[model samples]
Target: MTPFVAVVFVLLVLCSSTLVAHGGDAEAGAYMLIATSSMKPKASCSGHKVAPSNEASLNSTWAPLHLVSGPCSPAYSRGTDSSSTDDDVTSIAKMLDADQHRVAYIQKRLAGGDTSNGVAGASWDGQTTDVGTYLPASNVGVGAVSHVRPISSLNKMIGTTAAPDGTSAVRQTVIIDSGSDVPWVQCQPCPLLVCHPQRDPLFDPATSTTYSAVPCSSAACARLGPYRRGCSANVQCQFGFTYTDGATATGTYSSDDLTLGPYDVVRGFLFGCAHADRGSTFSFDVSGTLALGGGAQSFVQQTATQYGRVFSYCIPPSPSSLGFITLGVPPQRAALVPTFVSTPLLSSSSMPPTFYRVLLRAIIVAGRPLPVPPTVFSASSVIASTIVISRLPPTAYQALRAAFRSAMTMYRTAPPVSILDTCYDFTGVRSITLPSIALVFDGGATVNLDAAGILLQGCLAFAPTATDRMPGFIGNVQQRTLEVVYDVPGKAIRFRSAAC
Candidate 1:
């Protein structure tokens, strides 16, 4: 791993203390408190705490509270094995680091302000939280391991307001992935064809003159005198083409003319080409809006121009429509602003073969007046839109998801971790294995605890069974459910649901 990866790994290992599992105590209605802190513990169990003699009391008392600060620790008392797993705590810490790094990357990208025409509030906050439940030791044989659900609730949170200068105060959530089946898609680099001014007719194959004079577009070319338009045999043409021009032409009339033949050049226009084998079946989706600041009206007007949609679209007479708007360099709302060269492609060959730039612009529009006749009230609105400039196979979705996930992993501060254990039930007839884990964050980390809470609740309420019935059994006489509780004050989130 790189140094950066090493640093992240270390940070995650430190955060894992938060995820813990309780053994026989879970069924006996026993519970524990898990606490985490940034500072070194002056004493064991100093920064945080957990409570409850049984699962019922723990749920009713600790589940809803949010934590600001304290000596955090989970309260586990059934036996030495009831404590939180070290491996789980470690995994949660890594996941948290990943989350933070992801947010940081987005914040840096948005520092210059969003020009993508999408919403600016999509920046991420580095913090995250993971909560889930696991089977008890008693359910599994004494030496057998316990099993935990593979899927847990994951949330990516960000603060959305802005500062006085129009800079956002809180980062936005640009991307969210839950290991869901629905994948993400992204555009890839396509081959580009450069188009240059057609070579002189004298250079054509039918031309008989081995040395012919051609009009020079520049002063230096004129000094070379009459010469073959595409012949290096002539000193003037050879020096001019070889030294001045970077390209060596091919065919019978080949010459070292810089202004000749197929060369790499960017045209004023851009074109897209669908695969010849795959006919055109894709469409584009575009939209625009204003990002409002203190002065709503002015903000709206300014945004409209910046987004290149201030033309016939945002004005009156015609009904308002949500559609794709071309994004310009400095992005202005004026129609045909002569700013950035932007145009849509009906087909790939409509424009030059090159990567078309993507732009995001915000604009404001007028709002309807309240009951007052003939009076106008304008409201500043942030216009955001997404366009499918090109289409790809279903595999594109998987590629996009992978890209986003990789990016997220690089940016996260705390990643999830798991621990394995074995246990037997009260009758000793049923044995089960369980894996437990936790998510930890820094002081100001803003985690989507809501999602984590829901996932924990769902797992505890639902357990897989052979009969496909509600609250079904894994084997004979064994029923399982997940029990979860989050104590924000204690800086810990815990779950202890049963698995058959």
Candidate 2:
């Protein structure tokens, strides 16, 4: 038997003292508190695979959520697969590092800063990190993994180099991002080297019968914000967008037919048709970005009339599993009403308007609130998809680390991995016991994180922010396996556990 099995009973006794789960109402002034005593502990640290949802039968309002490198992803390539545990850790770290640049850029914009190019907050450059190396672009057949399929279209002027097969129709994969606004794709004229290499064929506007560039005087051009590059020679609206990792896309602002599902199609969808793109972090499988931010140009705002400005997504716990992003609330929303917890969607003048902000009241460890002041988290935080690790203010993170370390005295400590300092070695252990951690929000709603959310490669899945004054980030890792609902019109966000 393993050493862990022999001491299983002893560990259970230790866990009884080390862990506490209780249920209680938020105190009148408590900033944040940990998990309730009534909460239940998970069986193990190894994440469980979630079953695929029947999105087709559910309706046209649903879209599948897959990792860019996951096996189920349309962009998946055997040579560049990031499904392994070690690769996941490396990829996540790079993403987290890239997110810091995003935070810095947002801060600069809030301070009324403009880039050297005479555009307000147009530059997404900062102390960027290397996202990683990718293999040469290769073809991958397109198909729907769940309710959603690749956005396919007929090509008009396909280049021989880009479309070696000379096919009339091509499908492209997009990265669903909630961090920023403006949807865009590399267009046909983006010759090799000018645009970053991509697995799918570049979007050929000449082939798209419904394609039309917006005039410089159009309202769409005005809504481009800092992204508006200016007018082309023929008065076509031009746009330039840069990511925190220094990747950039510059092209004409155009409208096209965007297919959400077989039955749902949005005509005259505004998007970018980039003739040039540059970045090392741009995944070859991803042809472009689908922005879900709160800005006027975001997909959510554009489709508000049809979907009530409401959307929800369930992120799979593991890469092999499946998750769904839905435009409208499902019928199950009524049944899961009892399980739903909601908090007000906050707005702050000191933060980027395009981001989703929420108020965080306190943090609890082992059913007890951490020793941190509420004022530390007074600044509203953004719930981000690209960011992999939850970032807390320095004071808050230190307190959390200290409290967690105190509660986990029974376990052996492991060396730190990159930014994740609080780690434990669970080698030879058959079962694991963890102290319950809970996050308390402004409306008395508490979210007890899943085990997978709490640990990334056996280390605490959180880090300190660049500065205590900067806003915090609630990242994708903590959002795993939960249905996160964004009710834009209602000005509220809801959470339901075990959604996948």
Candidate 3:
């Protein structure tokens, strides 16, 4: 371990021992220290913290969600050729472009432009005017953006009758994307030119006797519907998935045993084994995406029988800190977490099935609600897992910008950075008080934003959509340090504070 980590580890041990000696809750104290140590010590603004709830103790079967740039990540790289601010700016630019592509893709799909009935190389005219490519043969999956996190998993050894051994199995790291429906990985036969460089080794099906291709006639293949890439000459089912940024992954639909978490082993888990995968949107460390959409092919729906179609995730407050995504709540629960609030999870027939929609009612700045019309936020807003920054319609955004700027006249303004127009120079400030912001959703469920969620690179983290017709989006930045739970069957989403 590095010197900094080693010191942190020793501090953790000491703190835990001291707390135990004082008859304090050692486990909770240790976790708090871990969370604090994950952040940069010299940060100008430390984020918010909330007490843990009983739900945390009850939940199990979770996997670590590590940022690709974090030290704890399997794909972490020490080559710091580029500064974090430069990377953030680049990521923001790419992410904003991808957001537009996502909205356009959804609009096209809702307008009856689905490619399920079309064959490969068929004539088509549905293309975005700004960005994105229309693969006449492929189903277009939207919302694959930058600033993503990955979950570690293992592939079961082929021809093994014995229990899954994580040590011997192939380990891979995949992005946990709720916007996309199909999970995929780079497989053997994918030349370096075809597949982008990834941290994990390519999955060679030849070595795994348990690997089997799905036949075109099977129900599993038919379930893909629009996602199918048509049957190959060998009668094997094929899939072609395209992102908003034109990244494509095309290969055979196959099945193999997968170990999702420590105690969660999924048998015959269907996924795309991509022979040809190419995308500049993904960095070198990312292997592929883990599907968490609401479709039948999504990981959530596929494992519904076992996991109850429920999952919860907490994004870390800082980039270097670690977070977690729990697949399912255990059979029992002690109680609900404090500051817990629930809002109805809305869905619309006009939208894609993969999206998770919610009704945003109003925006509150400094404990006072903005004067914008309620209709300004009437459009169904998506809970976008991949989007790094939240976006609002022009009307609501302007109102929020005005209110926020009015409240922050004390701090001197600095030049804008990329899409973040409102920035401040905190070079000499010792302590600062920021205006509190909150989002009031339908059913009066209010979610307060942490300092980290409110600002990015010393600027406001939110941007305005091109038009009011486009739906609003709740990005991951605003979700830091909070436990957000999605209960699909119950049609409700719960939120708890400071859950790590």
TM-score of each: 0.15, 0.77, 0.77
Those runs of model 2 whose alpha carbons end farther than 4 Å from true positions after fitting are: 1-60, 77-80, 87-92, 115-169, 349-351
**Mind giving the per-residue lDDT tens digits that candidate 2 earns over 7-76?**
0000000000011111222222222232322122222222224443342323226545544444444444
Query: For residues 227-278, could you state the per-residue lDDT of candidate 1 as single tens digits?
Result: 1232334332221111111221111111111100011111110011111111
Error of model 2, residue 199, in angstroms: 1.4
Worst 10 residues of 2 by lDDT: 6-15
Locate the minimum summed-lDDT window of 10 residues in model 1: 4-13
* lDDT preference between candidates 1 and 3, better one: 3
Error of 2 at 456 (Å): 1.0
By the TM-score metric, which is better: model 1 or model 2? 2
Q: Residue 264 CA error for candidate 3 (Å)? A: 2.1
Query: What digit string (tens of lDDT, one per residue) describes model 3 on residues 319-437?
Result: 34545566676544425544578889987776668778788899888778889888788777777556556878889999889987887787789887667788776556644556777
Superior candidate under lDDT, 1 versus 2: 2
Clashes of each: 103, 14, 0
